[model samples]
Target: MADELAFKRWKSLEPGIRKKLESNVFCRKCGVTTIVDYEVEYTNSQFTLKGSCQKCHGPVARVVD
Candidate 1:
């Protein structure tokens, strides 16, 4: 799907769907988007993604897939 549609679909999905799609989520860290190696935790209707930037030490955006 297109990036916009993908993001919309992700947002429209239920919590269970979010859990299943966690593997596809990526971290927009540094100048590159990288997949997180560790498992993501979902709670309180929100996700706390723990990952680092691949190119720089700056923070990254948590993207859902």
Candidate 2:
């Protein structure tokens, strides 16, 4: 119930905020800032972006503040 509401609110975030969040990750395995996709999720009352490194396919995650 509440989870769904939070998810919906996340979906309504501004495009610029999403873009900034999606672009601010460095891929350790690839040694580059190449994050192609961001999977936004809410956990423990915090939002996170789960993505993969485009060059090396390594896991990348960033906490949204």
Candidate 3:
């Protein structure tokens, strides 16, 4: 689930940038993998994406400034 403000900010980004961010997540089990089923969160003045890896269906997260 994404908070309202965070989701809004995420939606404001260009599609290409969003694609880059969603496709470039680090997963220990699978190295670099695309993120799926993600949620946007705003905390400590930063945006964090919490989701699962597309390859292995494992938990993954990416922090965006």
Candidate 4:
């Protein structure tokens, strides 16, 4: 896990990169675009995302650091 403050900094990245990450990212189980938030965890080894889909209303992806 990474420091919360550092994770906040990662969240402040440029919008273009953020969008690219969001699009390329997906749910671990569903393999869908359910990620609402994205961040590097454990020194960039893993990406944690938060948020759920508006259509399915299922378990939304959320940053889990």
Highest lDDT against the true fold, candidate: 3
lDDT of each: 0.47, 0.71, 0.93, 0.53
In angstroms, give how far residue 46 of model 4 lies from its true place: 4.0
Give candidate 1 misplaced runs (Cα > 4 Å).
1-32, 35-39, 44-46, 61-65
Cα-based TM-score, every candidate: 0.31, 0.66, 0.90, 0.45
lDDT order, best first, reads: 3, 2, 4, 1
**lDDT of model 3, residue 30:** 99
| Model 4 per-residue lDDT tens digits across residues 11-51 | 77777776666655455556656354333453454445545
Clashing pairs in 3: none
State the TM-score for model 4.
0.45
CA shift of 22, model 4, Å? 1.7
RMSD of each: 10.6, 2.9, 1.9, 4.7
Better of 3 and 4 by lDDT: 3
Each model's number of backbone clashes?
0, 0, 0, 8
lDDT of 1 at 63: 34
| lDDT tens digits, residue span 1-65, model 1 | 34454445446778776555444444444344443433344444444455544545444445332
